[model samples]
Target: MNKDLEKLACKDLIDLALLMPKKFDDLRLNDAPILNELNCTKVVIKSKKQLAGKRLTCIAYSYNWECECTITIFNARPFHNALFAINKELLIYGKLNDFAGLLQFVNPKIIKNSGEITANYMIKGVSDKSISEIKKKYLNYESLKAYDLLDEHIKLLLTMSENSSDAMLLLNSDELNECLKFVEIFHHIRRLNETYKNDTLYKKLKTHDINKWLKSLPFSPTNDQLKAILDIKSDLENAKHKIRITMGDVGCGKSLVIFAAALMTYPNKAILMAPTSVLAQQLYEEAKRLMPGFVKILHFSGAKTKFMQDELQDANFVIGTHALLWADISDASLVMIDEQQRFGAKQRMRLKELATTNDVNPHYIEFSATPIPRTTALINSDIYSYSFIKELPFKKEIETKLITIEQSKELFNHIRIENEKNHQAIIVYPLIEEGKTNTYKPLESVIPYYEKHFKNVYYTHGKDKEKDNVLSEFALKGDVLLSTTIIEVGISLPRLSIIVIVAPERYGLSTLHQLRGRVGRNGVKSYCYLLSKNEFSDRLIEFSKTLDGFKIAEIDLANRKSGDLIDGDYQHGASFKYFDETSDNIILQKAKEYIHKLQDK
Candidate 1:
């Protein structure tokens, strides 16, 4: 703890010193600006012709030293409540600038005076009827020595606070203590994890054994697919408990990574959780079919009966949706999370807690076919443990097109004809409503676009409530399912060849990639149509055209102008906030470094 923190009354002085703005619930500014004492200066309000409308008061304080000051109290605005309700001294924020020959303050924070004194007083009867009482109670000290007491770091923070525009520049500085700590720690831990990961006993598990185990399968795993499986095996068998993230492009065999991890953890069962039951069901079915003989892979979904839950008892490996958290199973030794971000932090922790409560060491392997912003994911310490699969499955590619809904008909019919000839098509929509609404683009509203254009059409969305069952039924019966992002991850429709996304520009790059993942499952030539409005930028348009997730991530990062994308969303772990710095990078880096240094110790 810093020694100077004791002098501060508030417990959150670091945050206060940084002046990080919070949403205005009540107006109680603790530290507002103060003007030096004035000897014989008469200030005027000149912005408004009439003093009654709204005017800012500039009071020149010049007793011992000469310094100009302006005090602004909002009238007839939402902020005026402070003028009537607040009686405490305030440190007015905002610039003491000149307006029409008189100094003025604009949009100032009404800071409260707590255990401090200053000489500046509001003019008598200038705006308020109760000025005399407010002045009489606060007229004692000529100067408050608050600035002299600020530490060097606290002073730098205040300086940065005064100039909001230049705050980000300070963040990129390597010489700063925060950055130094962050960079050193991140590099050390990253290197350590890499070293430890390489030395695990599972690395010695020959790929031949894995290959022979899957030899009876109808298809062979791709080389990149094989490498991912090996990586999972290595992590699971490591000495330390594992929490690894496996991020790859769509259909790069992340599921195979889960299977391989499950295979490595012998005598211990695996728990895989998906966002939806359809995805979980698909994983359960596939894992059951591919595993070695006598391996029990049971599934538990919210849609399942008590009998089904009973069947999952004593199973070696279990797959399920959020429903598994309620299960009474004690055998799950490894937790496999697919589309990890879809399940929030609480949901993920609940699963981990289930394993811990049973006194069993459970390793976690998270899979994300859609690559999210890496920096954003790392902001939370809880979800930072991750690795990437940068390679693609094969040299095979998918042709992408950006067209309007009207133009999609011709392509939809052509794809339908192709589907009849051994190729299947999937049409993805962004909404479930009949008309335009807030936040979501309804598919029922977009159905008319392809109503007469194609035959045997189906639709699904999050608004459907029981969308998992609808998606399962649609996957089997409908030739073309016009769905929302509900089918983002883990659902495998093997025969599907084409994906048509309506309003693709509105969706995140990660989501668009996942939607495209629905196709290209069987390694046949696949196509994804992005039907977007003209509002999309050229770069975003180009991004939608590629099947490469890593490329898209790079482009997204390059296009992001610093503080965008990841800053506002609900973080994966603890709600990470910037305390003394503008970016949470320093705190995150320091936390990671501390963890690594402790590991070394």
Candidate 2:
């Protein structure tokens, strides 16, 4: 790569082609000058130039208009003085300004050749000349064709890079925008295709009677959950190794799908990794109750490692926390991760590697309770197989509302009423300890007040060592739980009917949705109060209207810029500059078709 091109972040021909000009200089000679607009005309220097301080003034006669105009150059260099020599006929381009009654040209540029256009780039440390040269060398048909771009796309890029009159027209047209969007998506997908591989061998699981297993379940599986299980079932039966993600809203019954996948791979071992110990314990208990007695199930976490070695030998289904990453295990035909975004890339990969035997990678399926926008799922589907479960097993009756400090009495009375019914409430604070500049009360200061006013008040945060125990106890006996957002993703509190988020504006809509999901479990009537100083926040107000996590994700995307959605290994960084994931679905669909056509060739 050329150093100058590297400075502009151009790694290849495609990148160089996409480097569009910031502006274009039209130097075509005009028959008549348009006032206050850029014009180019042949002019004759009429008088000797006069220098005042750093300014130079001269008179020039426009041959086309047959008028003499005052030309002034500020901070004139030696080249400016030479260009305006007396009696010299030259072509000059500048904004034709009419000051008061006199026509004037300020710092007019001498055009060596008229009837041409020049591209002006804004790249720092790289001159326009260098960019032009790079474009001329690499922005040709043959160069871009090597990257498998469609011929029409290559031509459009060439026209844009040429800086012609047609280029200017295309710059303002929607056609160019569509073409750029297609190119970006096409390039990204192709890059992923080149690097993505599924060469690892895997033993195909024999077909099992999943429908019969579903019949024995206590409750009927929703259509979405059944479809997701079927999707995973198909992947397990295939000879090729599989990678799929099952995403859904909170309480969408993704757990049943996990167990179904494990059952499908029965006789062959299956393993699941959860984000927290509490979640792992909950899943272990659920598996024991729901799974049939024939399947041997084992739970592994930091606390239960003493007997893991002996238990692993014949364990048909293993569920554990991050401690499973370091455990010695083998011969697992399938691997599943819950809340996949919570685990790092290395941790997930480590668990998958532990299950691999004879270089055969286990079939991997990740479950996400954090719902993403449909458009993002569509775009990402080109890289990984996706299954979305939108239907909840039961309707959640969560009534969300925005409240202010003045409404404290009303909020407290509501909590008291819930407590009278043997229901529980949780107050989520933004911080554990009060900061010097904090505007809202922290958990430390508010816990004492709750302890004084109410009974069975419990508090915990991310740094708390006994958080798992606290959450377990809170689920059984606590009336009110005062804590931070640590309870956002774990535990199933059946009696949790009310959740009050302090300073709700400090969190993203998706996060706020996750916190709101803590309540309304078991289909009980619940309330979510957004305890904020500013009650009229449009985001919170809009959030209070719907219980759809997917819709909240869309709203979050609309409210935030790119690169704020997911973190850790699942993050799709800001790779597409022109493709708007929010509104470019049509273009993405077209690009997928075009790429498929090219693949057929």
* Reference-based TM-score, model 1: 0.65
lDDT of each: 0.56, 0.81
RMSD of each: 10.1, 4.3
Error of 1 at 59 (Å): 13
lDDT per residue (tens digit) for residues 281-324 in model 1: 78888888778867778778686646686677667778888888
- Tell how far residue 230 is off in model 1, in angstroms: 3.7
Q: What is candidate 2's lDDT per residue for 21-73, written digit by digit as tens?
A: 87788988888878999889898999856677788888889998898888998
Q: How well does model 2 score by local distance difference test?
A: 0.81
Worst 10 residues of 1 by lDDT: 37-46
In order of appearance, the predictions have TM-scores of 0.65, 0.84
Off by over 4 Å in 1: 1-220, 308-310, 358-360, 374-376, 379-387, 390-393, 405-422, 435-441, 445-451, 463-478, 553-569, 572-601
Q: Going through the candidates in order, what is the number of backbone clashes in each?
A: 18, 0
